[model samples]
Target: MKVITTSTQTWQAKLAGLLLLCTPLINACTDPSDIGLKLDPEANRIGVFYAEIPLSAYLVATDSLNTTNAGVLVAGGDISDYFGETEATAYSRMAFSTSATKPENEAILDSAKFSLEIGSLTAEDLDETKTFAAHKLTEPILDTAYYNFDQLGFEETPFASGSFMLEENSDTVVFMNIDEALATDLFTKIKDEDPVFDDIFSFRDYFPGFALKGSPSQQTTLHVNPGTNTGFKLYYRNSEEDTISSVYTIYTSSSRHFNGVTNNPTGTPTEIVTEKNKAYDVGALVGSKALLGHLVKLDMEPLSNFLDTLDNVIFNRATLSMGPTENFPDSKMPIQGLIQYFTDDSNKILRREEDNAPYSVQLGTVLQTMTDEDGNVVPAVTSGGTNPLVFNTSEYIYGPANTREGITSYVDALYRTDVMRTDLLLYPAVVSTSGTSIITSSSITRSLREYVVNQNSITLKIYYSKLR
Candidate 1:
């Protein structure tokens, strides 16, 4: 992915002249102690590499996202010249998967709807239609959780509405059209067995679910999937049958639903990522954004001060490279790759005392190749074409396992200056394997201002071992 038009302040002025030539040979070492106890029984190796060290990229955000039952529900609004208008609504509760049986005569209502089921769309939203609606939830999707900036209050009309349009691979759905006095008051309380169908907390105090929005002038973003043929239907017909089938339905409560979100960054570039673990400065102001969560903090302290000016070093191999922005296009909206994590200084996500879990990886996409000035070979596209996220980071700067006890070998926790220092964070993922199991997540539905992070193609490289 050749997009390295190079210049993130030219690798911060070449890692500030390699941290001023290794801080005066690390403060003129007179040896206050342990330089691995001054090695040299015959030590004289050498092998250096550092794609201009000091990497820094940011645009951090993400303050919330539990979104209860978040198996994708999201709604509409999608625009982004760099994450500006986002929107999303969905909330749920419905129920009645059992109990309540009365039909036989007197049921008359024949027609109501609601549906949902789409599951994805917004690979740059071509927009053939969109509208949607469905209101009626005057608060109550709570039996326990929901987050993503939660919110409530509804019923500003829209007992169902539509506009829809999808059809391509098929299985779309959407629907809407309800409101005939709220579908005849739930068809006169199931043809008169009322008492709110006596269960599930009196049918959630007599109905309290359905928000589902969409319609920010149809830029587009759907997702949806309340599955099992999403619900609400109603079509009865018994008043001595003269036609008109007999459905009922309600669904959508596999544990109350969620997805609230709102994001409005007032005109793009995520309005300088404004706080929440702050760190901005990735080029024209900032970049990394994905579903308002943003993220891209990488500070490997100038490659740990250039491996503290070598003194019998060892770390063999570490890659890193980067990609995405050149005019980013090509998308089934999965962002393609990047997940890295170790973070600290309040960016949290640290864990790993052997399975406390969090020292992650997975930067993905390889297959680069390149030669062509007749040397031939090719395929290395970047931006719209793709292929360039390489992050194998040699088990965090390989330090010969440093006697492994509770595992503190990220190069001895970056040369432990009494602790607190371990950066690397990147995030904008989506890996998915599952037949042999691989799964990685966090692609933040619809980020796409060319997705981001081409900070001059980042780099890193390392292969250390110098002692001369």
Candidate 2:
């Protein structure tokens, strides 16, 4: 997004004054950067999420187990008879959910029950029967799914948009394309005001009922109460100066969070909610819908811890799954290494069930690298996918499916851990700048907007020394 650059006079006096002020403050203060506005939160808030990305990669499936027990039950089932049985050859299709959809969306993707080598894939080296535990997902896929969409004769849309009943009588669909332009423009405007970034808060929100692209962005949805004019259209890299009037009012619905403000004149938007959308009479008041809606603008206390854990979680999975495309050269069954996490603890890191699982987060240490009969390292390959939420079981049944090799394969694709992680990761921290002194400021919507150039090139620099 381009900056709304405007020239200002008295530039000579301001630059000299700033250097002088900096000299004294820099010497006096231990950390001169610490001097800035203090932000206040609006209220007690928490974040609910559905998806996120990892800072690095991690391992998922392994060949060896580190349990003290000769054999422990695991989700993949027992391997007690691994060595007893013959080293059979079986194959399963290689695939990864580059995208995901809401559980509510119908299964259109030809998600095949990848034929498994049940007999050949034995954990016989294991002395005891082990089972991979069931758990919830913390960060599931929140994007589009080509596999399903292509089958359903639907094309993937580049944007996320939706509409709700304004109230009882108003039946208008709010179609929006909250593209990069919106974030860029908004951040630029914000930076134009508060460059020091004394108080810059970030949060994430979701619109469970609205999102269409796969699982969608965890913090993309938001509930905007249009004090009076209940309508807004957000286009990236744009600035609107009151087309007709300087004011506009947009009302919010119940739980549905909106990704952006877009009004489309297409499909006949039927009334879903019975309530009227005119009750939004107040200005700047946090509506109850904020909580009900999945859009979580996560804050400090919750999101920080969540992000710390989530980053680690996704990184592990990404490393294993996102490898080269050609994982196993010259093999009929080309399976992409979509990493899967299995913890035994009752209270799993993300979410878990009652199991004598260990209290260790050292998943990497315990599970050994997968190898073939010739002791060949099975290369884990993928397209660098985050934890994509499996929205359904019918398409690709995970639990107890018979393999071509005459053995029962049990699996329960879970979004519990991914879900829990998503909710916690996207709680946006509310950041506001307040002070008597003036500095160049820009919006934090887009990270790039935070940098101000041609002047000091300092981060979040406010162009104006004082409010005119």
Candidate 3:
């Protein structure tokens, strides 16, 4: 009872497969040993011939089959070669007997043994590789956890718990469901001396080409009896049914706010802040390098590259024109820095009593309501939910040191004629209701706005005399 090995034929099939797949380089560079294709040098493995058909079938005993003992076939006896072409079932295309299941059972007749022999297998010859009754199928197949006899081998083709008769020398086995998770584990077990040869046990019937000592006829005959589960290969072709494709670029993020926003919507009552939401769409200038510590800007690319960094630079109501004095938002104190700048720029070249200084303006906005798609009245955060523009704090950009703000100084410097010539814009479309439609609304709004400004940013400028 000599044990035979299929290492030789297996290598030939692999070579042919490699050439067919156009991966000749892999075949040439790889070694059967390095590739993990090996076996007990003297041991023999059973070999069986088979054909693949769509349906399942069993191997039956046969006699009176045509052979050197021919004429016995023409003689036609009651006895028929059950496994032959005549009595053969058309749909049934396989024959797996006891001898094929175990190495020891395969006598000189069923057993095949050969020595190392190198050979060639072109893509065209790949089809010539002998196939045996074996398979690896997908799991939970057709609901019953079926398996396909078409299954082949790679590193490990485990047999399910009760898939076969406990035969002697049964090195191959199948698991209920073998996925990539188990590929490595399975490969390690069945690879004789070379774990790399594990591919030979892969159910996909795929193998990397490696050196072989013999011709293509020396194939390892593996017997695979599908479990109660049906015949289906689960993700047979690829190590993974799903692929990992990831893309990575750059990213950035930041938080910003315009200092003016803290004041809130112009008309909003201090108590009303809790009642609404606000948004800003208009471009802002505060975030600019001006106002130094009063504003902060950042490089947004760090957050998300795709996201627009353009608008990421922003102004914080907290940091707006505010100085330690505190009127601006995002600030703990008032707009002292601004006051300093105003004082600096307003300082006369020689403090000439008549020196006229340059002038600039700060813009702020008021909050308003908008009807969203849902027809819900939404608080518009525009400019701290205030008006669309700033107070034009610039009027104070260059004013007398004693002025509440350049604006007030501007007022002081103005004469009756100058005041008349200077154009002032009321946030309301109409100065007072009298100028436009609902005169009533205008009057009320103008009165309230004047009062609020006078109370807040206005008062700070007047009393501080710090040119805030």
Highest lDDT: give the candidate number. 1
Q: Give Cα-based local distance difference scores for all models.
A: 0.56, 0.19, 0.19
- The C-alpha stretches of model 1 lying farther than 4 A from their native spots are 1-41, 44-54, 60-107, 110-156, 160-178, 182-223, 226-228, 239-245, 248-279, 282-289, 293-368, 376-427, 434-442, 446-468
Q: State candidate 1's TM-score.
A: 0.36
Comparing 1 and 2 on lDDT, the stronger one? 1
Q: Which ten residues in a row have the lowest lDDT in candidate 3?
A: 69-78
Name the lDDT of candidate 2.
0.19
Backbone clash numbers for all candidates listed = 0, 100, 99
Q: What is the lDDT of candidate 1?
A: 0.56
lDDT (Cα) of model 3: 0.19
Q: Worst ten-residue run, lDDT, model 2?
A: 446-455
Off by over 4 Å in 3: 1-249, 253-269, 274-409, 418-468
RMSD of each: 17.9, 31.9, 43.8
- TM-score versus the correct structure, for each prediction: 0.36, 0.15, 0.14
lDDT (10s digit) by residue, model 1, range 378-416: 323222222113222222111111111211233433443
